[model samples]
Target: MAQRELVCPEEMAHLVERFNYAPAVKVGQMVYAAGQVGRDSEMNVIDSSLEDHITAAWENVGKVLAAAGCGYEDIVEMTTFHVDLQEQLPTFLAVKDKFIPRQDVPPAWTAIGITELTFPGQLVEIKVIACVPDAA
Candidate 1:
Protein backbone atom coordinates (compact mmCIF):
# COMPACT_ATOMS: atom_id res chain seq x y z
CA MET A 1 0.00 0.00 0.00
CA ALA A 2 1.18 3.52 -0.80
CA GLN A 3 1.82 5.97 1.98
CA ARG A 4 -0.50 8.97 2.44
CA GLU A 5 0.60 12.56 2.89
CA LEU A 6 -1.86 14.93 4.48
CA VAL A 7 -2.21 18.46 3.15
CA CYS A 8 -3.56 21.31 5.22
CA PRO A 9 -2.93 24.98 4.73
CA GLU A 10 -1.90 26.92 7.79
CA GLU A 11 -4.91 29.20 7.58
CA MET A 12 -7.10 26.11 7.61
CA ALA A 13 -5.39 24.41 10.50
CA HIS A 14 -8.44 24.89 12.62
CA LEU A 15 -10.27 22.41 10.46
CA VAL A 16 -7.77 19.71 11.26
CA GLU A 17 -7.82 20.53 14.93
CA ARG A 18 -11.57 20.78 15.18
CA PHE A 19 -12.80 18.39 12.51
CA ASN A 20 -9.94 15.94 12.59
CA TYR A 21 -9.74 15.59 8.85
CA ALA A 22 -7.11 16.69 6.42
CA PRO A 23 -8.40 19.10 3.83
CA ALA A 24 -6.67 16.96 1.26
CA VAL A 25 -4.62 13.78 1.08
CA LYS A 26 -1.92 12.89 -1.39
CA VAL A 27 -0.90 9.38 -2.36
CA GLY A 28 1.50 8.70 -5.16
CA GLN A 29 0.78 11.60 -7.55
CA MET A 30 -2.93 11.94 -6.85
CA VAL A 31 -4.42 14.46 -4.48
CA TYR A 32 -7.97 14.10 -3.22
CA ALA A 33 -9.59 17.01 -1.46
CA ALA A 34 -12.52 17.09 0.91
CA GLY A 35 -15.60 19.07 0.08
CA GLN A 36 -14.87 22.75 0.52
CA VAL A 37 -17.73 25.00 1.58
CA GLY A 38 -18.08 28.77 1.51
CA ARG A 39 -16.87 29.28 5.02
CA ASP A 40 -14.48 31.94 6.24
CA SER A 41 -11.23 31.30 8.11
CA GLU A 42 -13.20 31.16 11.32
CA MET A 43 -15.45 28.49 9.79
CA ASN A 44 -18.53 30.69 9.69
CA VAL A 45 -20.65 30.31 6.64
CA ILE A 46 -20.40 33.24 4.26
CA ASP A 47 -24.00 34.35 4.21
CA SER A 48 -23.58 36.77 1.36
CA SER A 49 -24.63 36.81 -2.24
CA LEU A 50 -24.91 33.65 -4.27
CA GLU A 51 -21.91 34.57 -6.32
CA ASP A 52 -19.86 35.27 -3.22
CA HIS A 53 -20.65 31.88 -1.75
CA ILE A 54 -19.65 30.12 -4.95
CA THR A 55 -16.47 32.15 -5.23
CA ALA A 56 -15.56 31.53 -1.61
CA ALA A 57 -15.98 27.79 -2.06
CA TRP A 58 -13.70 27.86 -5.07
CA GLU A 59 -11.16 29.87 -3.14
CA ASN A 60 -11.16 27.24 -0.41
CA VAL A 61 -10.63 24.60 -3.07
CA GLY A 62 -7.71 26.63 -4.37
CA LYS A 63 -6.18 26.71 -0.92
CA VAL A 64 -6.46 22.96 -0.58
CA LEU A 65 -4.98 22.42 -4.02
CA ALA A 66 -2.07 24.71 -3.25
CA ALA A 67 -1.34 22.87 -0.04
CA ALA A 68 -1.21 19.65 -2.06
CA GLY A 69 1.21 21.18 -4.58
CA CYS A 70 -1.42 21.29 -7.26
CA GLY A 71 -3.32 23.93 -9.19
CA TYR A 72 -6.65 24.38 -10.86
CA GLU A 73 -5.29 23.06 -14.13
CA ASP A 74 -3.93 20.02 -12.37
CA ILE A 75 -7.44 18.93 -11.40
CA VAL A 76 -8.56 15.92 -13.39
CA GLU A 77 -11.94 15.38 -11.75
CA MET A 78 -14.34 17.56 -9.80
CA THR A 79 -17.50 16.80 -7.85
CA THR A 80 -19.82 19.48 -6.55
CA PHE A 81 -22.76 19.31 -4.21
CA HIS A 82 -25.34 22.04 -4.43
CA VAL A 83 -28.31 22.87 -2.30
CA ASP A 84 -30.36 24.40 -5.05
CA LEU A 85 -29.26 22.79 -8.26
CA GLN A 86 -31.49 24.60 -10.75
CA GLU A 87 -31.60 27.92 -8.97
CA GLN A 88 -27.90 28.27 -8.35
CA LEU A 89 -26.33 26.62 -11.39
CA PRO A 90 -26.19 29.70 -13.64
CA THR A 91 -24.44 31.75 -10.99
CA PHE A 92 -22.20 28.86 -10.08
CA LEU A 93 -21.10 28.46 -13.68
CA ALA A 94 -20.27 32.14 -13.94
CA VAL A 95 -18.09 31.96 -10.87
CA LYS A 96 -16.58 28.64 -11.91
CA ASP A 97 -15.39 30.08 -15.21
CA LYS A 98 -13.33 32.63 -13.36
CA PHE A 99 -11.43 29.87 -11.57
CA ILE A 100 -11.37 27.47 -14.49
CA PRO A 101 -11.91 29.01 -17.85
CA ARG A 102 -13.10 26.96 -20.76
CA GLN A 103 -10.27 24.88 -22.11
CA ASP A 104 -9.63 22.52 -24.98
CA VAL A 105 -9.82 19.69 -22.50
CA PRO A 106 -11.62 20.39 -19.28
CA PRO A 107 -11.64 18.34 -16.12
CA ALA A 108 -14.28 15.68 -15.61
CA TRP A 109 -17.08 17.14 -13.54
CA THR A 110 -20.20 15.97 -11.74
CA ALA A 111 -22.80 18.14 -10.07
CA ILE A 112 -25.11 16.73 -7.44
CA GLY A 113 -28.15 18.31 -5.86
CA ILE A 114 -28.94 17.80 -2.22
CA THR A 115 -31.32 19.25 0.34
CA GLU A 116 -28.76 20.55 2.82
CA LEU A 117 -25.08 20.65 3.79
CA THR A 118 -22.87 20.67 6.87
CA PHE A 119 -23.70 24.29 7.55
CA PRO A 120 -27.11 25.89 7.32
CA GLY A 121 -26.38 28.58 4.75
CA GLN A 122 -23.76 26.85 2.69
CA LEU A 123 -25.17 26.48 -0.77
CA VAL A 124 -22.34 24.69 -2.47
CA GLU A 125 -19.48 22.38 -1.64
CA ILE A 126 -16.67 21.46 -3.99
CA LYS A 127 -14.15 18.63 -3.96
CA VAL A 128 -11.58 17.57 -6.51
CA ILE A 129 -8.97 15.06 -7.58
CA ALA A 130 -5.72 16.37 -9.04
CA CYS A 131 -2.40 15.07 -10.26
CA VAL A 132 0.75 16.57 -8.74
CA PRO A 133 3.28 17.75 -11.27
CA ASP A 134 6.26 15.52 -11.85
CA ALA A 135 9.42 16.73 -10.14
CA ALA A 136 11.93 18.23 -12.50
Candidate 2:
Protein backbone atom coordinates (compact mmCIF):
# COMPACT_ATOMS: atom_id res chain seq x y z
CA MET A 1 0.00 0.00 0.00
CA ALA A 2 1.14 3.56 -0.67
CA GLN A 3 0.69 6.58 1.53
CA ARG A 4 -1.74 9.28 0.43
CA GLU A 5 -0.09 12.57 -0.49
CA LEU A 6 -1.40 15.93 0.76
CA VAL A 7 -0.83 18.99 -1.37
CA CYS A 8 -0.79 22.65 -0.33
CA PRO A 9 0.16 25.82 -2.11
CA GLU A 10 2.81 28.31 -0.95
CA GLU A 11 -0.03 30.68 -0.13
CA MET A 12 -1.76 27.82 1.61
CA ALA A 13 1.45 27.19 3.53
CA HIS A 14 0.96 30.67 4.97
CA LEU A 15 -2.60 29.65 5.67
CA VAL A 16 -1.48 26.52 7.52
CA GLU A 17 0.87 28.69 9.55
CA ARG A 18 -2.09 30.76 10.72
CA PHE A 19 -4.86 28.17 10.51
CA ASN A 20 -5.37 24.45 10.05
CA TYR A 21 -6.61 22.71 6.90
CA ALA A 22 -5.07 20.82 4.05
CA PRO A 23 -5.83 22.57 0.76
CA ALA A 24 -6.07 19.31 -1.16
CA VAL A 25 -5.80 15.63 -0.28
CA LYS A 26 -4.80 12.97 -2.73
CA VAL A 27 -5.55 9.31 -2.23
CA GLY A 28 -4.57 7.20 -5.19
CA GLN A 29 -5.48 9.23 -8.29
CA MET A 30 -8.26 11.44 -6.92
CA VAL A 31 -7.87 14.92 -5.46
CA TYR A 32 -10.36 16.81 -3.32
CA ALA A 33 -10.00 20.57 -3.15
CA ALA A 34 -11.36 22.87 -0.53
CA GLY A 35 -13.76 25.73 -1.18
CA GLN A 36 -11.95 28.52 -2.98
CA VAL A 37 -13.02 32.16 -2.87
CA GLY A 38 -12.19 35.18 -5.02
CA ARG A 39 -9.11 36.29 -3.20
CA ASP A 40 -5.92 37.10 -5.07
CA SER A 41 -2.46 35.57 -4.55
CA GLU A 42 -1.88 37.90 -1.60
CA MET A 43 -5.18 36.71 -0.06
CA ASN A 44 -6.87 40.03 -0.66
CA VAL A 45 -10.34 40.15 -2.18
CA ILE A 46 -9.91 41.32 -5.74
CA ASP A 47 -13.39 42.06 -7.09
CA SER A 48 -16.79 43.10 -5.87
CA SER A 49 -18.73 42.30 -9.02
CA LEU A 50 -20.30 38.87 -9.25
CA GLU A 51 -18.60 38.20 -12.57
CA ASP A 52 -15.21 39.28 -11.30
CA HIS A 53 -15.51 37.24 -8.14
CA ILE A 54 -16.64 34.15 -10.02
CA THR A 55 -13.76 34.49 -12.44
CA ALA A 56 -11.31 35.01 -9.62
CA ALA A 57 -12.57 32.00 -7.72
CA TRP A 58 -12.27 29.72 -10.75
CA GLU A 59 -8.81 31.10 -11.39
CA ASN A 60 -7.91 30.21 -7.83
CA VAL A 61 -9.27 26.72 -8.46
CA GLY A 62 -7.00 26.48 -11.48
CA LYS A 63 -4.05 27.44 -9.33
CA VAL A 64 -4.84 24.75 -6.80
CA LEU A 65 -5.29 22.19 -9.59
CA ALA A 66 -1.96 23.22 -11.09
CA ALA A 67 -0.31 22.82 -7.71
CA ALA A 68 -1.72 19.32 -7.62
CA GLY A 69 -0.57 18.59 -11.20
CA CYS A 70 -4.08 18.71 -12.63
CA GLY A 71 -6.21 20.99 -14.77
CA TYR A 72 -9.82 22.02 -15.30
CA GLU A 73 -10.25 19.22 -17.82
CA ASP A 74 -9.29 16.78 -15.12
CA ILE A 75 -12.07 17.95 -12.82
CA VAL A 76 -15.03 15.61 -12.50
CA GLU A 77 -17.20 17.54 -10.12
CA MET A 78 -17.74 21.02 -8.72
CA THR A 79 -20.03 22.60 -6.15
CA THR A 80 -20.65 26.31 -5.90
CA PHE A 81 -22.28 28.36 -3.16
CA HIS A 82 -23.75 31.76 -3.74
CA VAL A 83 -25.65 34.35 -1.79
CA ASP A 84 -27.90 35.31 -4.71
CA LEU A 85 -28.36 32.44 -7.09
CA GLN A 86 -30.96 34.01 -9.36
CA GLU A 87 -29.11 37.28 -9.80
CA GLN A 88 -25.73 35.67 -10.21
CA LEU A 89 -26.58 32.83 -12.54
CA PRO A 90 -26.10 34.78 -15.74
CA THR A 91 -22.77 36.21 -14.71
CA PHE A 92 -21.64 32.87 -13.39
CA LEU A 93 -22.38 31.08 -16.67
CA ALA A 94 -20.68 33.85 -18.64
CA VAL A 95 -17.55 33.64 -16.54
CA LYS A 96 -17.67 29.88 -16.53
CA ASP A 97 -17.75 29.78 -20.32
CA LYS A 98 -14.45 31.64 -20.39
CA PHE A 99 -12.77 28.82 -18.50
CA ILE A 100 -14.61 25.62 -19.41
CA PRO A 101 -15.64 25.83 -23.01
CA ARG A 102 -18.75 24.04 -24.27
CA GLN A 103 -16.57 21.83 -26.47
CA ASP A 104 -14.98 20.28 -23.40
CA VAL A 105 -16.53 17.87 -20.98
CA PRO A 106 -17.93 20.18 -18.32
CA PRO A 107 -17.68 18.83 -14.83
CA ALA A 108 -20.86 17.87 -13.05
CA TRP A 109 -21.83 20.91 -11.02
CA THR A 110 -24.27 22.09 -8.38
CA ALA A 111 -25.10 25.59 -7.22
CA ILE A 112 -26.73 26.31 -3.94
CA GLY A 113 -27.98 29.55 -2.47
CA ILE A 114 -26.50 30.18 0.92
CA THR A 115 -27.49 32.60 3.65
CA GLU A 116 -23.97 33.69 4.39
CA LEU A 117 -20.33 32.86 3.87
CA THR A 118 -17.24 33.19 6.04
CA PHE A 119 -16.39 36.60 4.67
CA PRO A 120 -18.75 39.55 4.71
CA GLY A 121 -18.35 40.60 1.08
CA GLN A 122 -17.76 37.21 -0.45
CA LEU A 123 -20.54 36.42 -2.88
CA VAL A 124 -19.25 33.10 -4.12
CA GLU A 125 -17.43 29.96 -2.98
CA ILE A 126 -16.42 26.97 -5.05
CA LYS A 127 -15.22 23.44 -4.28
CA VAL A 128 -14.03 20.89 -6.80
CA ILE A 129 -12.90 17.29 -7.22
CA ALA A 130 -10.42 16.06 -9.81
CA CYS A 131 -8.71 12.86 -10.88
CA VAL A 132 -5.48 11.94 -12.60
CA PRO A 133 -3.79 8.76 -13.75
CA ASP A 134 -2.63 6.60 -10.87
CA ALA A 135 1.04 7.02 -10.14
CA ALA A 136 1.48 3.51 -8.89
User: In terms of lDDT, which candidate is strongest?
Assistant: 1
Q: Write candidate 2's Cα lDDT for 1-136 as tens digits.
A: 7667777877778776666877787777788999998887667876667778889999988888888988888889989998888898998888987887564577899999998888677888989999975556
TM-score, candidate 2, is 0.88
What's the true lDDT of residue 127 in model 1? Answer: 92
For model 1, residues 19-136, the per-residue Cα lDDT tens digits are: 8989999999999999999989988888879999999999999999998888998899999999989999999999999998677889999999999999789999999999999989
Residue 99 shift from truth in candidate 2, angstroms: 1.3
TM-score of each: 0.96, 0.88
Best candidate (score: TM-score) = 1
lDDT of 2: 0.83
